[model samples]
Target: PFTPVEHDTTQEVYTLLHSMSHALVSTASDQCGLATESISEMIMPAIPAIVLYAKSAEHFALGGMATLFETRIHPWVDHTIDYTEQCLLDPPCSRDETGAACHACLHLNTVSCESMNEYLDRRRLVGGYDSTPFWDI
Candidate 1:
């Protein structure tokens, strides 16, 4: 029961990101309970384009089997990771408020950024990580 919208590559990409985030958050919250194999599958598709293309983190800094992407790499990277993490942290709601930061809505509002990115861009930058040593799948 998804609403119809203008079809374009960017929209499709955002759609994919949104769906991917939803599935991971749902899977984690539901029967799975946060396993590596499952999270890997969930995170793989959107990592490069969303993270790399967006100039975010190069590799997902995995902690044990938790499999969280590095939200501390760069501002853009941190923003994206924060956005995705909020989707994971919170669930179906993914509230406009209540997040460590909220850039997930950037896909929908990349132009004005009345949510997420504007808030993140204003955040103090985090440190320690490089674009070198990219993690390929």
Candidate 2:
């Protein structure tokens, strides 16, 4: 059983990783042909990594991820980094009370998210207030 303070810290880290996972999946969808809803995230908090994969056979049949990784991986990564720098609803989204996570920027559908859309913050990736961004700008 985690103490309340430890639990809070754990949740914060989870949200940061989970938000990043959503961001990656969203950007990958644009580079690849897969729909954002068709991809799922598996967050490994201990390792601090997220694995994105197709949620359904239909999405896998399209071979979008395979093709993207085989040839366009670099571009995909670049796009994700660039894409996270700004949001369609910037300023307000970045300053939102939720620590910069929102539907327009980082939220995913229930089928693709294991956390029920909770514990997410774009600031973890893009930087905010007193915290530094996880990615190099």
Candidate 3:
């Protein structure tokens, strides 16, 4: 009874974090010239903090990713927010209860995510008909 409801609530939160993480990876890849696979994410849904990092083939990947986050996190977040707000699979993805997120938008490589892309919705990162985004930015 309560278990399923609680799990759904937790999953909903994870979905938001997961979608945002994917957006961060997408932005990092586009801006940094690194593959999306090279970027990783640590999502603390409870704390509502998502840590995006570079996981290159070589050791530490020359610190470019760190410098990007350290210096440009604000812009990165702005970009991530704008990017997450829209998707190629919109309308349906955004309007549906599950949300407008699929492999194209929110799903990421398993290596980079702690959660196996199970509960994810880009609309949760932005705002949908049923929910509001956690971020004002």
Candidate 4:
């Protein structure tokens, strides 16, 4: 069950960025050896910034995450953007009328998200149908 909220243009932009953060976290987990659950995202839609970080239950956080951020963050962002430019679930996802986010792309572990993975649409990330991507503006 999900709570309903007023959807507006600004929230739509946050969704787009939040979708990108998910893509980055997925890619980072695969390429950087960090577990998907360890990676978390904080999206400040006011500043329009998505900050990705990692957590560990053990003391002395593993340095892999920091190293990845320093050496690979830029390329990771590039890859995420390229990946989001188009989705395998396009058309329907692109249409955006359905509020189109699914497990295949945008969904994340509930513990890793602030919004419980709601309000996301990759179409907004890349500009599809009637929405202009936040990046272009």
Model 1 alpha-carbon drift over 4 Å, by segment: 1-7, 30-137
Model 3 residue 71 lDDT score: 83
For candidate 4, give the lDDT of residue 101.
Answer: 73
Candidate 2 runs further than 4 Å off: 1-6, 58-62
* Residues 9-122, model 1: lDDT tens digits: 544344444433432333332222233222322123234232212111334323312233343234433334443433333343343332223434223233222122222211
How do all models score by TM-score?
0.24, 0.84, 0.79, 0.78
Residue 39 of candidate 1: its Cα lDDT? 34
Choose the strongest candidate by TM-score.
Answer: 2
lDDT of the candidates, in the order given: 0.30, 0.79, 0.72, 0.74
Residue pairs clashing in model 3 are 93-99, 93-100
User: Candidate 2 lDDT, tens digit per residue, 14-122?
Assistant: 8778878888888887788788888888887768778888877674635887888788888887887787888888899898886787778788888888877777888
lDDT head-to-head 2 vs 3, winner: 2
**lDDT of model 4 at residue 44?**
76
In the predicted model 2, the residue pairs found to clash are none
Q: Pick the candidate with the highest lDDT.
A: 2
lDDT of 3 at 101: 69
Task: Record all residue pairs in model 1 with backbone atoms less than 3 Å apart, i.e. clashing.
Answer: 102-116
lDDT by residue for model 3 over 43-120, one digit each (tens)? 776887888777755655647786676787788778887888777877776775655767767777788766666567
